[model samples]
Target: MSRHIDLAVIGAGPAGARAALEAAHRGLSVTLLDEQPKPGGQVWRAKSAAILDAPPTPETEAGNRLRQSVQDSRVTHLGEARVWQIERAEDGWKLHVLRDGRSSPLRARALVIATGAREFVQPVPGWSTPGVLGLAGATALFKQDLALPGQRTIVSGTGPLVFFVAAEIRRLGGAVAAVITPNSRGDWLRVLPGMLQRPDLLARGVSWVADLMLAGVPIHWRHAVSAVDGGSAVEAVSFRKLGADWTPTGEARRMSADSLCLGNGLIPTVEAAQLAGVELEHCPELGGWVPRHGEDGTTGVPGLFLCGDGAGIRGAAAAEIHGRLAGLSAAQHLGADTRAERARLHPGYVRAARFGMAMTALSTPRAGLAQLTTEDTIVCRCESLTRAAIAAEIAGGANSTNAVKSGLRAGMGACGGKFCQTAVARMIAKAEGRAESDVPPPTARPPLRPVPVAALAGDFDYFDLPIPRPAPL
Candidate 1:
């Protein structure tokens, strides 16, 4: 019996459905949460309403107006729920959540966290085959199971999601076979004079490179995909030539493809903002260790905020202007907006926080991509470990990510590591000069709802109550 709120949010994505539709249109009551039963998280993901009544695709019409602003009435949504931790209580933040198999407790005053951003995948060498995948898990299996893990895909990566997964695999007709991009068209012509000072983001990056060059595909650029042949599923890949500190070079071509779609970009899912302690800040141009926020997404935890791409990898129109400046700084921190309506919403939130700091300094990543791993690759695919056992636990001294998860437990399996804990905490903070927020992150317990220990021992409530009858005896 917990469930209370003023604004809980968590994530329904598209920055918690536009910060729960601008804090329930400024009246605030919200609740939102989501493990996704729908409400576009993985970049506008809903589907099934016969694919949401098919038709619209200005990216599913802003995720169908953020799922009709979470069906209004001061929002509640909850979808599949999940949450997991967030604590602070005495009268404000509890959270916990999880769903269906129960385990509740909510209560809020303002928490937002529009928890979003995943997909970085760096292990390589036939990346756990079975049709590879993860340009956002093949665009969330072509947006919610219309499914198309094959039929000759390739779509390697760098950013702007490999040209939006090769324009959603050419709008589902499939057969991409190229789009490689290890980011060097001379680093996109040196970020095109800072992307031509945003002529509408350089005309939507020149209309997504003119719809992947009129869907004839084949873009390659300094290429990448180093090795991914195939035995059981993905058919071929290999490529090379990246050099100038992005690595990969000399002779390797291959390319056949039956699904590869890699990724090397997104990061900030900051596990519920580092389980509510907030304050992180590596900012390798905003993708690793994010949440230090401000300019109205207010972090350093004071009624907790953080918006879009978990407050980093800024995309989706700067996550809808950082979800309208975290719903007008949480409606001016609950006095219900009016410092002249947040000074007339401060110049469109400082022009979407300076166009999300120039697209996070022109899509950062690419620092020799941690020497694209080798030493029999596989860095913690759920503790299978190797990359020479995380460089022999950073050459033993285990320097932070809780001392390399106590020397190579490497984020102790079962994805509590959340896909190899930020590339094993940025390769142990670049081999221990130390400071990816001095490492820490990796402990978010609770069945924050996975349940099914045989459905919690067949719904046992200490063998189904009724013991009070002994008092009557």
Candidate 2:
């Protein structure tokens, strides 16, 4: 049996939750689905019960309010529900969901994809080592479990997340050995005016830096990790000064640490949207390829909408506006009168977007990052392929991302290209001297995530199975 709804929101982050709330307010039967047990996405993910009584930050406070509002609203939220596939149907969209070991079908008149963004970790030698994790993943540890990544940690990466994660380590009572990044003070200064446009956020960022300085943490600018060293776990990290393009240039320095929190930045998670048949374009400022849509979130697809980080790398505040506009646009698509509300939110969306874009551009990975890898560094962890192997494949006629994937099985791993796609594409682009966009992403296939065979098989019996006859021999 299939459950039907007026609107189906595919995530429960700030954007998706708000989207469901807005549509439900308009008398629409909206259903919001998220992989987490609670709404808030990553930025606002509810803290663990162990730390529930900890002093709340602005993010936690805002998250609590939003969670309460949804709890009291008319929206129906299905938590821990994984949507494995979405397909166009005669009447609307069909979603195959796996929840609690059961498979179910959900059909909705309209769909909103707020799947959000993923951290982009550039590959360095020994990046696949056990103790190496992304900055965002480290934050998740602090937020959800109140646990630290290591006793002494080396935080190295680009973007605002680098600062936030290092500050979080100190706040959580963990020791931060040092902070390293490719952006020098002068580089950040160039973007200060635009960042200042959001004075409140600027203040928050300053506070993080203040905390690190007060703790006497050394901040190394214009540097990046050259390699990680260990036999089984991270024993030490090697770093070096970087050129303007982020290529290593100076003598390497070694820092002993039990763990390394590293990440380049974030990119929009567009697999779901791509599978939904929305058009995509390469917009580096938006964090690589993003869906093509209007201001109101209407895509070329008739009833599909995209918002939040999934649409692009606009931060959470802008994501909320994006969600609201999408909700109103979706309501209107389903015959609700929402023009007034839509018009009201447009200006704010534009403002937030400008600030967010500036931040994204500042944090965008430099081309020199591509030079960080050695011939033997693992580029695709799943298949254990090296940079040399991938580059050789490129020279051997794999000009496109898909072609490389087909030849070497780089992205055919369990992660479904989540980790390796962008890095691989960069390798292809650099080798072929083509624009990054020229190497289009590999084609999106169905069953958007890996599914257990039993879940899909249901309770079918051998006698009832639709067995096929053998082909003519």
Candidate 3:
């Protein structure tokens, strides 16, 4: 038996939650799916029982409100369900969902994808060490298991996340050995136009700055992490004065720490969109390749919609607006009048988007970041493929991402290239002597995620699966 829904939403993040609420209110049978066991996505990740419950931050407050709405609106919340394949169907879509090692087919009249985003890390030497963690990864450990990465940690990277990560470590009584960022105080001035308009963000920034200063936590701006030290675990971190060219200039400084928490920025998650044949373009301002979408989250596909960071790299607030718009648009498609609701969200969307553009301007990763990879630096976490190996492939006429993957097997890992494709694509661009945007990301294949053989044994047959035709743009 196939489960049928009027609307099938992928992801339980701010976007998908709001989308589900919107459609459900319009009297649609909605099923909201997420791979996580809980409702909140990354931004509002639900904590485990062992951890001391955190008081609701603004993010959690808003997230809980929307999540509560979804729960009360008769929307089906499918937690711990992963959709690995989506094929064209007679009605709308046939989604292959895997849960607890069993695969089932779901038929949906409409689809909403809000897969969210992940941290973008610079590949530096020794990052493969056990204690090294991405900024978001560290947050997940703290939130999910109430676990700390190390007793002593160094938080380094760009973007506002560096500030938050450092504060969290300090709050946990973990020694924040140092905080480093490539952007300097002067860089803040460069994006003043955008920051000035966002007074709410400004006030919060002031509070965080004061608290960190009062706690005696040293913040080293205009500095970038040059390397991570120690054999099996992070023992030290090396830094150099930030330069326009990303060269290790002046005296290199070292800080001792058991763990390195680092992330420069975030990249949108668009695997689901790409697998559905939605068009994507590389936009550095929006944190690399994002699905081409409209204000209402309309994509190239007629019945499929996109929202949140998966569509662009906007923050939580902006994502909320996008989600609502998408939900309302979806409702309108179902023959419900949503004129007033769309009107209400449009202004907030515009206002937040201005701030978002400024954020992009202020926190854009420097081009010099591409040079962070050295011969020994690991590019693919799954295969342990080295920069040298990828470069060797690129030099040998592997000018495209697919070519490099074919030769070096960098993206043929458990991650399916999500963890490494950006860096690998950049390496290809550098080797091919072309622009980063020119080297396109590798194509995505079905089994978008790993699946169990038992899950597909009697319920599904790959050979019987029909090819999905692209929807009209």
Tens digit of per-residue lDDT, candidate 3, span 1-473: 27778989999988888888888888988899999987878888776766536654665566567667766788899899999998888888889999877888999988999999877788888888889999988878766665778998889887677787787777667888888888878777777776666789867766766778888878887888888999888889998886865555678789899999988788888888998889889888888889899988887787899999899887777887899899888887767899898998998887777676666655577667766677889989999988888888877788888888888787898888877888888777766678877977888788878988888896566779898899989
What shift in Å separates residue 281 of candidate 2 from its native position after superposition?
0.2
- In what order do the candidates fall by TM-score, top score first? 2, 3, 1
In candidate 1, what residue range of length 10 has the lowest lDDT sum? 447-456
Give model 1's clash tally. 1
Candidate 3 residue pairs in backbone clash: none
Top-TM-score candidate index: 2
TM-score for all models, in order of appearance: 0.34, 0.96, 0.93
Clashes of each: 1, 0, 0
Order of quality (lDDT)? 2, 3, 1
- The Cα error of candidate 1 at residue 384, in Å, is 13
Q: Candidate 2: deviation at residue 177, Å?
A: 0.7
User: What is every candidate's alpha-carbon RMSD to the true fold?
Assistant: 20.6, 2.4, 6.3
TM-score of 2: 0.96
Question: Candidate 1 at 335: error in angstroms?
Answer: 5.9
Between prediction 1 and prediction 2, which has the larger lDDT? Answer: 2
Model 2, stretches more than 4 Å misplaced?
A: 461-473
Error of 3 at 137 (Å): 1.2
Worst 10 residues of 3 by lDDT: 51-60
Cα lDDT, model 2, residue 230: 93
